[model samples]
Target: MLSDDELLRYSRQILLKQVDIEGQLKLKGSRVLIVGLGGLGSPVALYLAAAGVGELHLADFDSVDLTNLQRQVLHDSTSVGAQKVDSAIARLSALNPLARLVPHRTAMDVDSLDAAVAAVDLVLDCTDNFSVREAVNAACVAAKKPLVSGAAIRLEGQLSVFDSRVETSPCYHCLYGHGSEAELTCSEAGVLGPVVGMLGSLQALEALKLLAGFGEPLIGRLLLVDALSSRFRELRVKRDPGCAVCGNHNG
Candidate 1:
């Protein structure tokens, strides 16, 4: 049951045919884990909170630097030197006081990551590096939770959904082998501010669809954005039968 305030806050969302009162309530009852609080995390956090997700667990260890202000919209000049999760939560809480925001200021260890993933209904992988992304995906696959992963570098962006809860759905490890990939940082690669923002916003949209059971969530498909040319493309992705993380072979 929605409080009068909730009804009024989410009335526009509820009015959508695909997201009637029932869908809005589902969103209000769901919990999500956002595993980064940088450029991608900024919009993912804001939109999810605005959409009335019941609880949001934010995990990030970095402190805000002036450089982050370019794309990390959740923080302001005052947040410089503050922990990313703390800065993000402060802004998110103000955006929607009705939503519960949990901040994890430390980098998640293996057990901590697994526990967090198991505890949440869904996860958004907003981290930049492949190591953290791999860890997050492993935990999500182990817990059989849905994971929405997004990345933006330079003027390019990519988005994908890997739902282990579905039998045929590919886990993140299926798309990219467990082996490490060359790490790319926004600092080195130089990302356009809005590129990450666009990817993050798309992540939020996918999360809402997964939670509210409306529209097709991007499962087993990758959406690529070429911000340089303002073009978008889709690539079909498949589960690897021998994927170490989600495959039949088990040690």
Candidate 2:
């Protein structure tokens, strides 16, 4: 049942034909794990919280840095020395006291990553580092969980959903070969402030749709947004029959 505040807050979404009372309930009953509290993860957390996702698990070992002011909006200037998870919790709590937040201040190692993945209904790969992205992907694949991955740099961003339950959906490793191409980290190559927000917002939309079972997700397609040209493109992405993690491990 929605409280007066919830009804007022999400009235727009609640009134939607696709996201009616039942869909809202599904969103409220869902659990999501957002790995990384940086640029992309910021908006993803805010929108999901406002939309009333039941629970959220946030993991990040880094503290709030001044340099992140432009993009990591979740952490304000006042939270400079605070832990990323701490700032995120405070922001989300104030945004919606109804949300249950779990914070992890340490990085996820192989031993503990699976447990994190297992606890959530889905995992959002917002981490900028390719290595960590791969690790998160592996964990989701192993747990047979859906992974909504998004990335942005300069003026371009990419969004995709890798649902192991969907036989035709492509895994992250399938698009960017398992170990090919030089890894790109957002730290070294800076990301435009709004670019991350744009991508992250789309990620939140995709996640909500996935939870509510509403619209067609980016399962077998990659959507790329170019803020520079104000254009967007979608390319057909296919699952590799030989994908080591996703293909071999039948979810």
Candidate 3:
């Protein structure tokens, strides 16, 4: 049951015909895991929390750096030496005290990652590391959970939703098989703040659609953003039958 305050707090979104009372309840009942509390994770966390997600499991092992303020809006000058997850908690808590915040301040290895994925209803992969992304995807595949993945570097950004629960949907592994060893990070290649912010915001929208059961998710499609030209393109994606991570699950 939504408290009177919850009803008032989320009235705007709840008013949407697609959402209404049922969808607001769904959002309040959903538990989400957000991996990475950096550039991409910032907006994802903010929107979801403000939207009234019941519980948010935040995972990040890095401490705040002064440089992160440019894109990581979840933190501030006072958080420079604090852990990212801690800073996120402070900001998100203030944004919506009705939302519960769970922090995973340490790096999650295979076993821990598996447990985390299993505990949540959905996951948002906001990490910038390919290896971490692959690991998170494998865990989601094994747990049969939905994953909303986003990435941004330089002036380009991409967003996708991979759900092993959907037969035709591709897992992250199916789309980026054994990613390049030379892949660059934002720190190395340099990314505009709004580029990551855009992808992260989209990632949040995708998660809400999935959690609230309201609209189409990017389950079998990849959205590409070209900030320089201010254009958007989407490519159809299919699950790889031989995908090492999710193949057996589908079979």
Candidate 4:
């Protein structure tokens, strides 16, 4: 149950018919793990923390650098040189002290990722590297967890939900063909700051809907955002029949 303070703090969100007090309670009881603290992770952290997600676990190994200020709104100039998780935690706490914002300030590896995800209900994949995305997806599939995966580069962004708990939902590997890290990257390419924010917010929305059991999630659909044209498009994406993670052929 929400305390009187919480009831007051989240009054606007709770007032939504789809997110009444009961739904608020569900959010309060949920644990969400975010696997990055960069551009893509910025708005996800802010919105989820503002919405009163009970426990938010932030995992990131990078420290605040000057270049990060352009998109990583969680940290300011003063936070440069500090741990990214530290900057994220401080800002998120200030936003909603009621929510427990736990920070894993080290780089996530297979073993650490497994342990971090064990108790969480949802995972938000905001990491920029393809390898990290694949690793996070594999772990989520192995643990049968739901993942809201998002990416942004240049002027394009994408959002999708992979619920291993659902037989038809596709994993990250399904949408992004498992391969070497030679395709897309923020390093070689440039990304608009707001593009990342837009997708991150969508990721938070997907996570909230999943936790509250309110709306149909993106599941097998890939929502694309083109900031250059301000166009929002969603493509039908189905689980691959031969997908090794959650397909029958590989199983």
Best candidate per lDDT, number? Answer: 3
Q: Model 1 reaches what TM-score against the true structure?
A: 0.97
Model 3 residue pairs with clashes: none
Over the full model, what C-alpha lDDT does candidate 1 score relative to the true structure?
0.92
TM-score of each: 0.97, 0.96, 0.99, 0.96
Worst 10 residues of 2 by lDDT: 177-186
Order by lDDT, highest first: 3, 1, 2, 4
Please write out the lDDT profile of model 1 over residues 90-132, one tens digit for every residue: 8988899999988788988999999999988999999888988
Q: Give lDDT: candidate 4, residue 176.
A: 80
State, as a TM-score between 0 and 1, how close model 2 is to the true structure: 0.96
**Candidate 4, residues 1-251: lDDT per residue as tens digits?**
77899999999999899999989999999999999988978899999989989999999999999988898888999999999999998898889888898889888779989888887999999998888888899889888999999989999988999988887788888888877767777767878888898899889999999998899999889998889999999899988888876675234
Error of 2 at 98 (Å): 0.4
Best-matching candidate per TM-score: 3
Q: Which candidate would rank higher by TM-score, 2 or 3?
A: 3
- Lowest summed lDDT over 10 consecutive residues: which window, candidate 4? 242-251
Off by over 4 Å in 3: none
How does residue 157 of candidate 2 score in lDDT? 94
